[model samples]
Target: MTEHSEHGTQFVSKKYTSWPAMTEDINGGTLHAAFILAPLAMVMAREGDVPVKIVHLGHRDGTAIVVRKDSPYESFADLRGTEMAIPHRYANQRILIEKLKEDFGFGDDEITLIDFNPPEMPAALEAGQFESYIVGEPFAAKAEVDGFGRVLYFTKDIWPKFISCVLIVTQELIDTDPELVAELVQGISASGKWLDEGDERLMAGVHREGHIPVDPGRGAQVIIPDGFGTSPRMQAAMIASQRQYYNQDPELLKWVLSRPPDRVRYTELALARDEMEEIQRYAERLGFFSRRPVTAEDPFGFDDYCDPSFAESGRRPLPLQPADGQ
Candidate 1:
């Protein structure tokens, strides 16, 4: 989704479905800003080649740990020496997993860590490849709805007000057009407001009516996984096609609708400076900055990476405008 500022500034936004593509776009100058995972951004920044700074947070507290619905495991304590998968070492999921281990008095060897792409996680779990997988939704939600897994814990339950994704910009963009960056943040914040309202379906995209393929054998009980990673503009049509997947079972619908919204101010999008500091400490603890170690005391001259001044002007409300051709 995109929004225009009253200054007659037009913003065009695009979605990159994968991390590599998103990071490539940011580093290659194809896009000026992005909603990216926080730790990964920190890693890129410390590596010194991808000069991007996190200006605002995109989301928070929307991660979970999932296990097969029929599994005997009950908690982190029950999964001793079991196979576990996380998206990557740089992901917040790994930190939480470590915290889980420490809290439960489990040794590092008690959990066999495996890295799996988010989409592959469900299938891997279903096939018993791993006992549990931790990732961000709608993947976790996808597993539950498909009846293959159930949530063991939500990161929100463990780490209150946890910060995850963030909005970042290339250093060049920040230097060349700070106002434009502010405008973009304002636009995204407004979009978040619309999304937070929760019934407008603006976040869900355009729907078109027609017959969509569903398995005849499953009858009306077929669960189509069409819109899992769909862009907002396409989610309407994608969701429309997958109605049975969402509506066939009231309990599942309740669960899907029950996923909590990320905690965001909506009107003023700014980096959670305190949380970012915590992330920096965790990254260092996890050895992400081993080459150029960033500690709490000597955070390696990284304090300048966070600049909240843009947010000062960026938080201003956008003047409502008519939709195109209205």
Candidate 2:
């Protein structure tokens, strides 16, 4: 129930379970900055659905689609009409589904969607509740280790190097206290850098001691490098795909598109308006926005969201000593 303040010396928060739950917490004024799916955060920030903006990329290139080990499916086309599990409609997994439909003619009705939190996906797949699932790391790696599932697609292969999670905060925080936001961003960036370290044994040992009891090798398999930045390409990829996922409502798009860009603030990065615009144009060519939400206001124009003072002043993560006596 604690909220961050401009003058507070510490940042404390109650843990949330899922993306939707985390979104709700931030919207309900419980949390300040959160590690969230990039697309969902942008979608929520659009049209002021939530008073938040993305500040930094938390992690990148860590999602995969997993199919049961014994299943005969070899590609997206082969999995038509099968049951699949996803973390949520707002997750990057939905973009993969859309890509399948675009490339291989898979119908929305062809594959059944089963909703499960990422943590529960492995057990559900092993129990035969679904034939396949798409989720972020650890869960996918767990399935591989437990011998119940095999990776079929890594989303990076489909999109040109996209981001998965991002750090977000309320617009009020950015408006009021820029220093606090910078500190938070630096902390998250350093953590991601630490996670991206080459020392697998240390990371694996920490993983083993922390939550899951898996071996170092298994832990290494799930760990992926998370590049931190405010790359316009990353923003465009997330926004364009999200717009397509929620293409059912033209009015919603219109409302979102007409809204002025929020003043986004960052530490070391600035908004890449041109790259995002180019991405939007390309996405339009690919039929991402068949409805054409707003012709005037560009959703990718995040100048309002661009305040990189914090990012510029903050420090990145440095290498740490080896763990587990490595």
List runs of model 1 lying over 4 Å from the truth.
3-13, 197-257, 260-269, 295-298, 316-326
lDDT, candidate 2, at 94: 68
Model 1 lDDT per residue over 149-252, tens place: 89898876888666667787888988899888887776666655554442323221232232232322211221224334322212322432344322223333
lDDT of 2 at 181: 90
Native-vs-model 2 lDDT?
0.56
TM-scores of the models, in the order given:
0.75, 0.64
Candidate 1: count the clashes. Answer: 1
Off by over 4 Å in 2: 1-13, 47-49, 197-300, 304-309, 316-326
lDDT of 2 by residue, 187-301 (tens): 6555444333323433211222233344443111111213311122222222222322322232222222222111111222233455334433444444444443335665444
Cα lDDT over the full model 1 = 0.65
lDDT of model 2 at residue 8? 31
